[model samples]
Target: MSYHNPVLLQESIDALAIKEDGVYVDVTFGGGGHSREILKRLGPNGRLFAFDQDPDALENEIEDERFTLIPENFRFISRFLRFHRIKKVDGILADLGVSSHQFDEAERGFSIRFDGDLDMRMNQKSKVSAKEIINSYSEEKLAEILFLYGELRNSRNIAKTIVESREGERIETSFQLKQVLQKYLPKAKEHKILAQIFQAVRIEVNEELDVLREFLQQMPNLLKEEGRLSVISYHSLEDRLVKRFIRTGLFSGEPEKDVFGNSDVPLQKVGKLIVPTPQEIKINNRARSAKLRIATLKV
Candidate 1:
């Protein structure tokens, strides 16, 4: 099967306003879909660099002279680009969150429907996996992940149940974990709750929130003056950080104003937030929760 079907393809590409001779970076290069679109817009003189921590993505790397695929986490985007002698770029595009390929492969263990080993590391090289988080994390830590990352309302009870159940045997698989949380799973909303649980595990395994903050901090320095940034975030936590960073150059609530009564933000919002059309969502259900935010770097 195809690795992934890029969400908001055209909308994201259009937001970049690609220049024929400009340099660009696709910070999340799953399946090369977005990279291919960017390459098509670039002239021979233009250059594109793509990053994907998943070793699986390297299989889809484009064999083009103008394109360079970096098989590493985008959290170090600036460091990697600089190593390639690229100080600044015309634009950067990031489609954050887990890719469809990761979820579909049962062995990768990203979905609740799968009865497979709980291993949700985006980078196969990573030491921690969902299995570790499920089996070893303390009840307090588990509750924190469920509440903050998954937004689960009954996090305390769920964490308590997990700790109680794991005393006899290690929770080894997705099915095992599901069985432990069965009581908390609402009958009519089982899938929804299960998804939330899996999401929480995945985020913890990958340290996604920390990675996102690190990547966003590098954007202003990586982008040239007036360069664009088009990011698509799937969950509220990710969206909140992106929105706050664009508005105030901070991931928190608000920025402190300078003595001159001006906020020292590096980015200027480009337009209103964009979402997938009903047609697009119908074609790819994963696009349903996707939110695109665009901004341009201040000179």
Candidate 2:
């Protein structure tokens, strides 16, 4: 059970400002760490609905009548909640980014330290694995993904190298891919660069950005009046989406003003952005990039 250490654990739960009997949702129940904390904060009658598309997470399901674990993706939050006869929840928590367990498990192919199959799907059944992305994507498309998702400046060259190497034989495993691009990874920055490269491939394989957008769009309808959304994102791309959506209700540009001359965003920021304390990060190195953003439905 070497799952994630739930970065900013107490802070995130406090962001929900939990009510004794309010309905809540943990949309990313990876290790069930956050969900277990939520259950502890709830009264006997309170309800918690958790979601995780990964089959591995199902083993950690909480044993309680008040808790329901939904074995599905959080992008389909609204639909699944409806099936459970829940229209509006008092609070929703999402911990974005890959779980620690995924990184630790070599076979999952989510870590740069491990040599494994290039299969980085969050859901095991996903059709597009990292192997397919590396082997099949056009150089231009690969460059785009690398630049946009990994923030790599030399994406064109990297993608070119991958394409050239794959022509001889499929880049089927993590080690094979690494060996192909070994020249690009100088000893000084090898780990950082490889992590970025793997990040780009993983994001595409899981359709993470698209999933985040879809889940955010459903928030206005899924939450009760004054309900809260407490999201913990591990990268700038995701943090920006949550921040922008909370501020303007749109991912890009500005939302039109309402009759009262105010922005029509459905959610308003609850407080300043929260990040892990140095002590917390010391305890869990993964918390280094973690950013927590809290918001509530507009009054």
Candidate 3:
């Protein structure tokens, strides 16, 4: 399980303002890159817990007395942490979206560059997969996913084409889906368009946005006063949610205010948004779109 270096490693961790004796959670412990760093900074009394639903990630778990790896999705962070008798934490870090390992593995079907089965389940045990969404979903439903998740303007035509093509033969493979969508893939922007299409399918299959919402809603209650949240998001959709939630404590719209014009937002933004330096992006192309946002529970 080879994973790329964690994006915004130093910056995101710095946002945590770690206390040597504090407890922390790395909610996306892909290859233990961030967790290892956290452990390095922690003292003997400090504790670190990580979560990853991917079976492949389990192989890369760290061997440290103070660190615990939870073999479950981060959306259940509150429940699982409760089971461990942990009701609050000093900081929480999330490196959101798919990991490099998931995209590099041909069988995962997460990469548009690969020609593999449409099995983009982060958790192998998940019931729904890209295959089921592509082949079984209705044209209208498919169109909605593409428009909303992929932000594709021509989603209706794409959905109509997919529904028609799959009628002749089931769209089981990535290359096969590409072939069906070839007419829409202009050479000038083929890669970008294909990426958007695949992104839509992957998000739908994984219920990523819903899971994110669930995980975020738990933050206010889970974090102690002034507890930190450091998140790195790859795409605009995820970034928007984090930005909005941090500012207004709601995914959309402004928070309600009383007669005094005071709104009770749960979290406050710590600083301006951060992105990977040109040097970092040069080293790892995947870091190009990474955006780091820091927040803390409002006092």
Candidate 4:
């Protein structure tokens, strides 16, 4: 039940440029660490809404009158906020990627160190588990996941091997999948390779990238005139999307320019990328890959 320290806590919250009376959001309210900090800086009139798809996160809900926890994925930020009779917020903070608690819990199947079921669904209620993907996906489909999600160079061969191995029996757990591809995991790079493979499967199971895009698309409409968007991404893919969206307001391609060579964008970058310091990383290793990007509505 312990949800260890959050990564890049102070830096991410500072990037929000929180206002005493303005409404805010913590889109990834896993351990409630960032949410708690936001509350500490808010005034009596300020309101905060947080989101988490995982049922486990409900346990960590903050108990402040000004704070409300939404037990759902952040991808539905706009829909859920509207349901609560809210349209605009002063600032939005998203700490993307998996929570440390997810990795520590062996049964969650988010860690390679443990022998657990292949159930990497952030929402335990989700029907599509990692087991289903590894056992049912065709070689071509599996290869695509490994190559695109995992960034594996020998994805085709890896997929073929998985297909061949799983044919004899169902791949029911993390350890089983590891054993099937034991040949690829050498002592020198075992952890790195296994992590990449697990990351690909987890991302696919949760539809992380698609959900991210959907959430980002809603930011412009959800924010107030001077509202801020503070996001922390754990990998290059998510960071790229945030960086691009902030710069040009699109995931791919350049923004259109007018006769004066001025282009319109929903949000403008607040500052350079913010990362955790050595002291913070030493305290929480997960902070190593964290990248915080802050942006505000374009004038």
Among the numbered candidates, top lDDT falls to 3
Tens-digit lDDT track for model 2 on 140-236? 9999999999999999999999999999999988899899999999999999999999989998999999999999999999889979999999988
Instruction: Give the per-residue lDDT of model 4 (tens digit) for 1-299.
Output: 25857777788888878899989999999989999999999999999999998888899887899999998989999889999999899999999968888998989999999999999999989999999999999999999999999999999999999999988999998899999999999999999999999999999999999999999999899999888999999999899999999998998899999999999888999888888899888877888898999999987
Writing each residue's lDDT as its tens digit, candidate 3 over 1-299 gives: 25757888999999999999999999999988999989989999999999999999999989899999999999999999999999999999999968999999989999999999999999999999999999999999999999999999999999999999999999999999999999999999999999999999999988999989998999999998889999999999999999999989998789999999999999999999999999999988899999999999999
C-alpha RMSD by candidate, in order: 1.0, 1.0, 0.8, 1.0
lDDT against the true structure, each candidate: 0.92, 0.93, 0.94, 0.91
**Which model is ahead, 2 or 3, in terms of lDDT?**
3
Q: Candidate 1, which segments miss by more than 4 Å at Cα?
A: none
Let me know the TM-score candidate 4 reaches against the reference structure.
0.98
- Candidate 1 C-alpha lDDT tens digits along 65-121: 999999999999988998999999999999995888988999999988789999998
Better of 1 and 3 by TM-score: 3
Q: Candidate 2: what lDDT?
A: 0.93
Please name the candidate that would achieve the greatest TM-score relative to the true structure.
Answer: 3
- Which regions in candidate 2 have their CA more than 4 angstroms from the true location? 258-260
Q: Which ranking of candidates, highest lDDT first?
A: 3, 2, 1, 4
Model 1 clashing residue pairs (backbone): none
Please say which candidate is ahead in lDDT: 2 or 4: 2
The Cα error of candidate 2 at residue 142, in Å, is 0.6
- Clash totals, every prediction: 0, 0, 0, 0
